[model samples]
Target: MKIALIAHDKKKEELLDFVSKHKDVFSQHELFATGTTGLRVNERTELPIHRFKSGPLGGDQEIGARIANQELDAVFFFRDPLTAQPHEPDVSALIRLGDVYRIPMATNIGMAQILIHAIRRNEF
Candidate 1:
């Protein structure tokens, strides 16, 4: 499976923690992430990751391309709804592409954990 991870500035630590706790499960698959989030996650776990540009700088589009190409299996996008983003369209497109591609996507922590757990349990 190929998993793409993205986190808003405020959720980076939480995302990193989640990845660290589930390193074993994540290690079995390929990982992709936006620049700073990937760097933060790498600091906490050994999961191999392909890093893209920062979300505001084209990372969302990079990941969106993979989703459109049917190259991604799942996505965890930890967006901060309370804060407005400069790249709203890119973010929206990524979310929309995930839906069009039928790939599982989690925009918050609860859903992210649920999806990861389901994948680990072979319930997908």
Candidate 2:
């Protein structure tokens, strides 16, 4: 499976920790992530990741394109909803594209945990 990861600036550390805990499972599949998120995740996990530009710099669009082409199997986007994002449209498109393509998407830590656990159990 090809998993794409994206997280807002404030949620980067959370995403990194999440990936670290689940590295055993995640190591078996391909990983992709936005710039800073990918770098942070790579710092703690051995997963090979394809890093795109920063989200505000078109990384969201890059991931959106992959989703649209059915190149992604799942996405874990840890968004900070309480904060305003300058690239809201791109973020929204990524979510919409995931749904339209029938891909699994987790917008928050709770949902992301569920999906990751399910994957571990081979339920996905």
- How many clashing residue pairs are found in candidate 2? 0
Which residue pairs in model 2 clash with each other? none
Give the distance in Å from residue 118's predicted Cα in candidate 1 to where it truly belongs.
0.9
Q: How many clashing pairs does model 1 include?
A: 0
Question: How high is each candidate's TM-score?
Answer: 0.97, 0.97
RMSD (Å) per prediction: 0.8, 0.8
| Candidate 2 lDDT score relative to the true structure | 0.93
Task: List candidate 1 segments past 4 Å from native.
Answer: none
By summed lDDT, which 10 consecutive residues of candidate 2 come out lowest?
39-48
Cα lDDT tens digits for candidate 2, 1-124: 8999999999998898999989998999999999988988887786789999999999999999999998999999999999999999999998889889999999899999999999999899
Model 1: lDDT of residue 116: 92
CA shift at 49, candidate 1, in angstroms? 0.7
| Tens digit per residue, CA lDDT, model 1, 11-46 | 898888888888899999899999999988877786
